[model samples]
Target: MKLVIIDYGAGNIKSIQFAFNRLGYEAILSKNPEEIKTADKVIFPGVGEASSAMKMLKESGLDTLIPTLKQPVLGICLGMQLMCLHTEEGDTKGLGIFQTKVKRFSQNVKVPQMGWNVIKELKSDLFKGIKENEYMYLVHSYYAEHCDETIAATDYEINYASALQHENFYGTQFHPEKSGNEGAKILQNFLTL
Candidate 1:
């Protein structure tokens, strides 16, 4: 199956690539519109700030193409954040696929909640075989508010939307490629979808 990882020059892409390799699937990293449009599964991975990443997407014309994708599209971390309507970070607008808003964690909790965290309230086939409250690696400050599209929820400062699914589009605030065994299962499940 053709798996394409969107490479707009804003992510920790190598690890994601290696993760897929270990899973015995080749994830092609491409900014090309045609290559992405034809893929059976598309992985949108990002690891940087919002506005600039959106800029890169615009430069590649992916900003327009991504939302129109007919196949399953998975957004990771910043990729997921950008899939929302808007983010408080950089005061930027997002792709508007998910009807939610990204907000910064309060000053009470630490910024960039790094390390392992449990994701519960699973609601999609994406978590198929993945047990509830399973630990997944995460590193982000902004989170999408709970909405009708939320499939999984995680709590740091508050219970917020950690995973979201809107029809063919799926997103995870945590990095499945970095989350060990459970993470791998999630990626594998996505491929089956």
Candidate 2:
């Protein structure tokens, strides 16, 4: 399969590429529109500030291209946050693939809820072989709020959408590449889709 990982000067691209490699697929990282559009599957992985990321996507014309993707597209971490309607991180507007907004974690709890957290209320093929309450590695201060697109939910300081799906688009607030076996299974499910 022609798997393309959208590269827009974000962190964690290598780890995602390596994770796919471990699954026996050679995934390419590219910012070219044609390369991204023609891929059998696309992975949008990001780890950085939302405003800068959105700026990069807009500059590269990817902000317009990503929403029109026909094939399955997976957005990880900041990539997922960018798929929503808007984000509180930088008062940035998102692609709006999922009709939701990303908000900052409450101040009552430590910001950037990091480490393994259980994801439950699974509702999509993304969790086909994975059981409910499976732990996924997360590292972010902003999160997608619960919405109709939320397929999986998690709790930190408050209940939030851990994963979301809308049509062919899928997103994960956690870093599946760093989530180990369960994470690998989730990626495998996405690849099969």
Candidate 3:
């Protein structure tokens, strides 16, 4: 199957590509909408600030194109945050695929909750074979609020949506590419979808 990673100038793209490489699947990177539209699977990734990332998506018309994709699409990190209805970071509007909001963690917790965190209450085929409370790599300050779309939840200062799914769209606030074995399984599940 043709796999495409949207390279809209914002993401830990090389690492994601390498992750797929290790899975024995070649992932193509492109900013062209037509190429992305034709792919069997698409990955929307981001690693930088929110508003700026949204701007880049808008510039490429991906902001509009992403939500309409019929094939399975996975959004990672800021890409997942951007898939929500809105984000506290930069007061930016998102792709609105997840039907939730992204809020900043209070000062009571570490700013960027870095390192491995357990994700529980797993739902969706994306987590198939993945046990509950499995650890996944995470690094972020903003988080998606719990909502009907939330397929997996995690705790830092409080419980928050770690993974979301809506029809063909799937998103993970954690970086599966960086999360090791189980993470690879999640990506592999997405590939099967």
Q: What TM-score does structure 1 among the candidates reach?
A: 0.99
Distance from true position, residue 14, model 1, in Å? Answer: 0.7
lDDT of 2 by residue, 35-124 (tens): 999999999999999999999999999999999999999999999999999999989999999999999988898987989999999999
Q: Candidate 3: where are CA atoms >4 Å away?
A: none
Best first by lDDT, ranked: 1, 2, 3
TM-score of 2: 0.99
Lowest-sum lDDT 10-residue window in model 1: 11-20
Question: Number of clashes in every candidate structure?
Answer: 0, 0, 0
Q: For residues 39-145, what per-residue lDDT tens digits would candidate 1 score against the true structure?
A: 99999999989999999999889999999999999999999999999999899999999999999999999988999999999999999999999999999999999
In order, candidate lDDTs are 0.96, 0.95, 0.95
For model 1, state the Cα shift of residue 15 in Å.
0.9
